[model samples]
Target: MSPTRSTRALRAVDAPQSTLSAAAGELIDADPLFVRERTAASELPDPAPLVSNLARSVVEVISGVRDIEQLSRWVTDDVYRHLLIRTQHAARARQARRRPTRRPNFVELSVRIQATTENIVDAVVVLDFGARVRAVTVRLEGLDRRWRASAIHVL
Candidate 1:
């Protein structure tokens, strides 16, 4: 990110702690299951990539796809080569048989991020299949001033 954008995030993190007049935030904030850090809504970083990439990987796998390269690009290290081998094999087998293997359903998502000083982000995403949890992945990465994904995991 540009220096200006970096400054904006810094200012947000350093805001005075006394101001308390604001309307409700996103609709999800009202849910009993919602837990948030950085008391101010302004502090929440955009999680779309984390959410989207996560959903895409699960959906791609369960759909019996052989296009591991695409999903591999989003992963860190050998998750594509080592960790995901069984999944890829299964997908390829299902495809060869011309039968559907499974479908992806997002079970839950949780993230813990710290936005001041140096940024740290950790994410956990779960995908379900019918009554069973099909996959669970954990991701950890640091953002530069730009807050881009630097590393991702399938753990």
Candidate 2:
């Protein structure tokens, strides 16, 4: 058989019918029990303490004093990846400078949290690092019955 003939035969056997039944559409619309439902902001705990702690922990991770894995459970995958990259860069810089890994001397100046929706909150955490001040912005979303950081930015 020619190559084109065999390819066509295989495609015909492997391809599924494009028609979708009403039952399938209904199933798609129905909520599955296996998937966790997002919780409302009101149902979640106050985000101030968590935001402050997370900001501090993030700074520590970037300063080589804390592990990025410790913050994984509280942040989304994208945020975790971003933190991991920052941590690695920080570690390399510290290594290049031959600096000791020590806890950062920082104080939480203030935390401001605002609710944008029923399940979303935006927070800004201010920190005083003795000589410099920094702000960490975190977006918290209620997911799986808890508040998780979906986005974080340090400036």
lDDT leader: 2
In model 2, residue pairs whose N, Cα or C atoms come closer than 3 Å (at least 3 residues apart or on different chains), thus clashing, are none
Candidates' C-alpha lDDT: 0.50, 0.89
Model 2 vs. true fold: TM? 0.77
Error of 1 at 115 (Å): 7.9
lDDT of 1 by residue, 104-139 (tens): 455444434433333445445554455765434444
Candidate 1, which segments miss by more than 4 Å at Cα?
1-45, 92-99, 105-119, 143-155
